[model samples]
Target: MNHASAFDMDAFRPHDHGRCRRAARAAAERECQARGLRLTPARAFVLDALLESHRAMTAYELLDRLREAGLGKQPPIVYRALDFLVANGFAHRVERLGAFVGCVHGADDHRAAFLVCRSCRQVAEAVLEAPPAALTAQAEATGFAVERVTVEAEGLCERCRADA
Candidate 1:
């Protein structure tokens, strides 16, 4: 599947969560094997937890899930898994909220932009081909080499706006 073009928001809501989780796990496994990376038990479990929900989750929230699953009841366990996932491009950290969200776009390196729903904490991610021209130009003018960029926009989602 073309990860970038295949993304559909409707598929993420109130559907077969089990299938979604499985597909994500399978994708990760395949990608890891292709890249010679080890997807340890803890890493897999944490990835599964994030994939199970489209909503972004804090590290503490992920720790609770790890505890429930008998993975390990320590903060370092979750952090390590998170670090590995983020470093490998399997996950992205929402700097605005200090939380993590799985990369639904498979495990490829791409610029990420997020539409964050503040009220419900739902996060939708899109893979960007390049940094915004404005940002690029500004960086060039300042002689700053831009490596990676994360653009996040925060607002209430449709449901939240309607509720208000």
Candidate 2:
């Protein structure tokens, strides 16, 4: 994450989740239109499911949702949707949890850092301006091209901490 900037993640605080979900959908529509990408019903549904909360959800969980919605019963249905979403920067995969979350920020490609709650499994997303200096240095030394990075810090969220 960008250490120089101040950021408040709504996931860590109370906010109008309805408004956030609607805005994310609208942004996805606009982005798809601009990019000439097809936002299929299944894709939209998967995105909506991910945006419904800050918690990371596994593919099987998402597939269950799809099945309940009568979208698809097969695994490939959700997997393809996830593939498109991750490819277009509309969603992020939480490696630690082996799950996924919708991107809060718009479709613009940006580095993301996450604060993951160990107790509740909620994830707060933050933008990183660039790769960390130490990591970049190590990669350069090894002649490794760093294509992507997933930074996740695990701990308790405020609500969970207070409850404890």
Q: Which one is best on TM-score?
A: 2
Which regions of candidate 1 are displaced past 4 Å?
1-8, 11-19
The true-versus-predicted C-alpha distance at residue 148 of model 1, in Å, is 3.5
Report lDDT per candidate: 0.81, 0.86
> TM-score, each model?
0.87, 0.92
Candidate 2: tens digits of C-alpha lDDT, residues 1-164 = 34523333788888998887787788888999999999999999999999998888999999999999999899999999999998888898989899999887876676678888888888888777776778888998999998877688898999999999
Compose the digit string of candidate 1's lDDT tens values, residues 1-164: 12233233542356676776677678788889999999999998889888877788999999999899888999999999999999988888998888998887777777677778787777877776777888888999999999877787788777778889
- Separately for all candidates shown, the number of backbone clashes (residues 3 or more apart, or on different chains) is 0, 0
Q: List the residue pairs that clash in candidate 1.
A: none
lDDT at position 78, candidate 1: 95
